[model samples]
Target: MSETVVSVRDVNIYQGSNLVLQDVNFNINRGEFVYLVGKTGTGKSSLLKTLYGELPLREGTANVAGFDLKGMNWKKVPFLRRNLGVVFQDFQLLTDRNVHQNLRFVLKATGWTDEKLIEEKINDVLDKVGLKSKGFKMPFEMSGGEQQRVDIARALLNSPKLILADEPTGNLDPETSDEIMQLLFQICKDYGTAIVMATHDFIVINRYPSRMLKTERNRVLDSAVPA
Candidate 1:
């Protein structure tokens, strides 16, 4: 049996009065890499938002990395996000800062204050993401693949147990997407970080098949079981 890290039961989400997700339920386990797929606007992003408390779970319950989303307050949102490493379709790296500086920015904002230790940690995570020599390069100076690697490195600075990525490879070409997926999968295997990535690329799914969840007909479907 897998260790459950995220559990969503009968969850419903609303955005300014429109019901986006209805009765969504799933259990993602530790060290797992799961894919979230559906047509655009099927509520994949909303479900991820609800799990991370970006949107409120008004009709049910979701517990992610030990925090209950249904009852959590704004003060706890940062705490919830701290346990998660979130990646986006766009590389949200700062153009002004070099790769190492960008990662150090996250560490400092998250309350890491040690000078020597923070530098060491930044180098460590950059090395882990296979971007050791590029730490001094700015985001625009690197290739798209390298920039995405920096995004992953920034997400790893806090040692999160779970990563929620929404359309993380939407902008990349196939080869670059494959490299990024490999890096994410390696993170799961090496650090036991459970990942829930929402994507629309079918070829990637066929290549690295895992447990999947899809949003369809306003319901979340568990792809491992017969529908």
Candidate 2:
């Protein structure tokens, strides 16, 4: 049976007091790679925030990584996030820490206590992102691409079932963006992790086509199921 990693139905997304998206409906399955594309201020970020519990899901029946979005409290948001990985446009790595320390800090905050296990998991994710040898390097020591890799490694720390990637390739060059795209698709195929990536790079989207969800005129239009 195919598993639904994210299901949003009749969702009304808000930013502050404005209704950004209305009556949104979509279903993302395990191992699926879906692209979220739209112009700025079209509710792409708002929708992504809703999925990862950054924005409140009001007037909707939505479930993400098995967590119901309705009535989600601040205390419960972290638990919901534990099962979902979020990638930002700007790689939000701690500048004060090296790659390994950055990853370890996330693990520790997420309740990981065993030192040996943390080390092992760190290596595994680093290896997955092709940065196994750069764990000791500081964030400033790496290139934008390398730093982005570290960000991806951090996202994998929890072995999350779903990843909400917000413009993951927004800051990279063509070559580096291609590399990140390959890595992301590989993760989805290899680990059965569903990915919902928000991007405005049409070159990358056209280069690597997948199911697309476009945010236009206060609604989400799915290319897979044409309206």
- Candidate 2 per-residue lDDT, tens place, 1-227, comes to 89999899988888888989999999999999999998998988888888888888879799899999997989999999889888888999999989999999999999999999999999999999999999999999999999988888888899999998989998999999999999999999999999999998999999999999999999999998956
Find the candidate with the highest lDDT and give its number: 2
Show how many residue pairs clash in every candidate, following the order shown. Answer: 0, 0
Backbone clash pairs for candidate 2 read none
What TM-score, to 2 decimals, does candidate 1 have? 0.96
CA error at residue 210 for candidate 2, angstroms: 0.2
Backbone steric clashes in candidate 2, count? 0
lDDT of 1 at 176: 91
